[model samples]
Target: MNLFIGLLNMAIEKDNDRALYLVQKAEVLAEIELFYLLPHQRRWRSWFPEVIYCRVDVEKTRIYIKEAIKKGKWNMDDWPEMKHKILKLLSIDDAIIDLAV
Candidate 1:
């Protein structure tokens, strides 16, 4: 879409640390989500399915969102408060094994 292209261009032109950080964070989240789909969702997928396929896979989005956590840094260029809150969403004592899965 033209709007999407425009936004991308703006993000690229800004040369802002917040923009860069957000872009990198989004890429990491996308990479994590890209492969995490159930069989039924996979069947529903299609080319350029950004609204569905490309979006983060919420283990069961059909259910309510009890929390919203993504491991690692989720802060702005200088917002440690946000980082702490976001990281605390889903505390995992043993995530390495789950990361492998």
Candidate 2:
């Protein structure tokens, strides 16, 4: 976590567009993993609710989504649609969305 933040900070400090792009990509991937794990990880879920939420009606939503995706629930082309959902779930506010884009 510290390493990720350090790289992101360096990208911003240097104003390097390519590095910024890579950092953003890394951020998205990390957040997806967080989203997938948060449900089962009680400590993480308790720690992060103030920071973000997801579109779910009940528990195990993340697990179900992961299973579905693994079982051909979405095609490669469908990921573009889901990407925005993942971003929204990971974001704490409008500022986060702005930074991500």
Candidate 3:
């Protein structure tokens, strides 16, 4: 998770390649946890079903990447409009971030 956050920060800084690498790493980690680890952790299994968690993680990463890209393209003053536009176009619900953990 820390690595993913670092990658998100890097993406916000406009380091596209590094951000993509980090996103890929995050995806792999999600896959591992969903496919391998979680199955054995029955207590957690009810709350974090594999398919749902994996999809949510991927979606969150996508949203972070899109937001970072928009942030890079515009100055802070323009961010509100940019974020609004991107969110609208992407159809990304703000509620997803809260549910992502």
Candidate 4:
């Protein structure tokens, strides 16, 4: 995650709030991913460290992702390949996968 934001920071103009905020959102989504995927993990030093212990509703998460995607002005084609694979592996619908990625 550090490397990703570091590269993005270096590639974009310095002190860019929009880019940084987008990265921050991405990091949160990543945390959400781990929260659902990992069953035995304890904690992570994030905004919500006790996410693993807290309830993680899959259907709610999916709806959350859908809502987020709808609200953002994101480039539809700029999704990472790993996102594609992850959503596909989880059996996400193709149309929703397009937005989630």
Q: Which candidate achieves the best TM-score against the true structure?
A: 4
lDDT of 3 by residue, 1-101 (tens): 58666766667577566546556666766665667675556347564455432233557756675566555542335667776665666676655433432
Model 3 segments more than 4 A misplaced:
1-16, 40-101
**lDDT by residue (tens digit), candidate 4, 1-101:** 69656656665566665545566656656656576556544344554453333344678656655665667633346666755664565466667646545
Segments of candidate 1 deviating more than 4 angstroms: 16-44, 48-101
C-alpha TM-scores of all predictions: 0.24, 0.27, 0.27, 0.30
Candidates in order have lDDT scores of 0.45, 0.53, 0.57, 0.57
- 64 Cα displacement, candidate 1 (Å): 34
Query: What would the per-residue lDDT of candidate 2 be over residues 1-101, giving only the tens digit for each residue?
Result: 67666767777677866535565755655675666565566356454443433334434554554444556563435566575575356442334334433
| Candidate 4: 10-residue stretch with minimal lDDT | 47-56
Worst 10 residues of 2 by lDDT: 92-101
Q: Largest lDDT belongs to which candidate?
A: 3
Error (Å) of candidate 3 at residue 100 is 28
Candidate with more favorable, higher TM-score: 1 or 2: 2
Distance from true position, residue 99, model 4, in Å?
7.4
Error of 2 at 43 (Å): 9.9
Q: Number of clashes in every candidate structure?
A: 0, 0, 0, 0
**Which rank order by lDDT, best down to worst?**
3, 4, 2, 1
lDDT of 1: 0.45
